[model samples]
Target: MSTAHAYYPSAPMPITMPQKPGYYPTPAHHGYGRVSVSPPQAESVTTSGGASYEPSATSSSYAGSASEYDSSGTNTGVDLLDYMGDRLHGAFDPVPLDRSLAKQAQTSGELNAKHRELLELQALAQRRLAGARANFADGMRAAKEVQKDLQWTQKRVDALNERAARKYPAEYKSAQNRYPAPVDY
Candidate 1:
């Protein structure tokens, strides 16, 4: 269990008390900052609706398997308080402190491994985001370039059409007769 001094001092400090009239003394040390502790892990048999964290036969009492709890009267799959009370009072064989410490160390190791994996994933996500941003920029540039090219091509085609009308008047007139200009709205 973790312990820390509470806010709102319970007793007045001797150092803070003024020694003489109109003599204000500064505190040698500051107040204790926030002491954040990780929330207690739930002692659930199952983890987030996943596989059971069944203790070994020696580690636990009154159990054939984790699933056997449903059939057993001792454990109704509820009443965490009662379950802990039973363990504390030795209703079932108590787990050794050293063994419990080892279990905790193992759990810490697993958590560290998971943390590393998560960090790697975060790095990968950052890389992907950077790549996506670059690709977007490249695509935008390409689109703008294509639009400019299309405008230039259209201008060139109009110039060619004008030239054709002037140079091949007879042919152009025949073509215009075959395909009349579209009516404006």
Candidate 2:
């Protein structure tokens, strides 16, 4: 007859230690040395003010179940072709009736609007240039008049100096005595 050992659920498992000294000592104790080595009791996590959270039966399977894309997610072949055609035509094909060209044509009537604008700008610039030329000519004339006035004033001063020397011979002689004429002159 075979004998079966009885199992005791309440008893802790036995651990064997090494017999020789210095060969293998006991494992270095953790924070609590030589203390009882039993499995830690399960801790109950609670919220603030000691409120325990108990999940409802329906909550376990409800996450992300209702959120989903529409069933008609696949694109039809015709829709894809139309989308592709639109993109291709927009990239490669020239527009037949451009609004900008139509607007220009309508505004210009017979002459090109851009060309007319250029001509108007050129005429305005020409008018400005002519006015600038007239102003420059007037400035030159004023400068010449000022030069003529300055020459007349200089000639009058020279005449006055000569008359003063002629009228006062004694004073002129005294001035000459003080400052003799240059030898070269």
Candidate 3:
């Protein structure tokens, strides 16, 4: 079975008072400078018949304290260990090569000569490649321009043909009429 309650229609609703000033004071020694801490009050749940219910005080304080205290903890021994671990692991190891292998490597004079030769060859190849590429690009561009010019010339010839037909229709007709179709043998 369930029970239900109803409030009187004419009754005045309850009112809550304004919060107190300086309710939260800063801790002087912490050096964080004037941080306010206000504990949240437990809300009163009121039934329709004016029956008020409050949650447990201990439970309410726990929520507030959890939020307030949640932060990065101070640099402890574990932190120091982690930092030392990172520093040690992050460092690059010194590479050791065989002295005999190094001695067997190419001589400095020979290396310098080869390097110079390589540089000279690279420079010559670069110049030739650049010249070839430039020539190719220029040729392509010129071909495009020539194609455009030929199209323009064709357009001009067509215009001229149309103008000649309008201005000298008789001559135009005569020229077309004179050119007879050849009979295939």
The residue ranges of model 1 lying beyond 4 angstroms of the native Cα positions read 1-97, 166-170, 173-185
Quick one: RMSD of model 1? 31.1
Show the colliding residue pairs in model 1: none
Model 2: residues with Cα > 4 Å off, grouped in runs = 1-111, 168-185
Candidates, ranked, lDDT = 1, 3, 2
In candidate 2 the C-alpha lDDT for residue 84 amounts to 45
Candidate 3 lDDT over residue span 1-185, tens digit each: 22323222221222222223333332334324222233344444344445343444224442454544432332111233333444564573434345545655646667889999999999999999999999999999999999999999989988998999899999999987898445779
1-185, model 2: which lDDT tens digit per residue?
32222222222222222133333233333311122223222222344444223333112221223222111322111233333445565586455558668877788775676788899999999999999999999999999999999999989977976897999988988987899866864
Ranking by TM-score: 1, 2, 3
As for model 2, its CA RMSD to the true structure in angstroms is 28.9
lDDT against the true structure, per candidate, is 0.54, 0.51, 0.54
* Candidate 3 deviation (Cα RMSD): 27.2
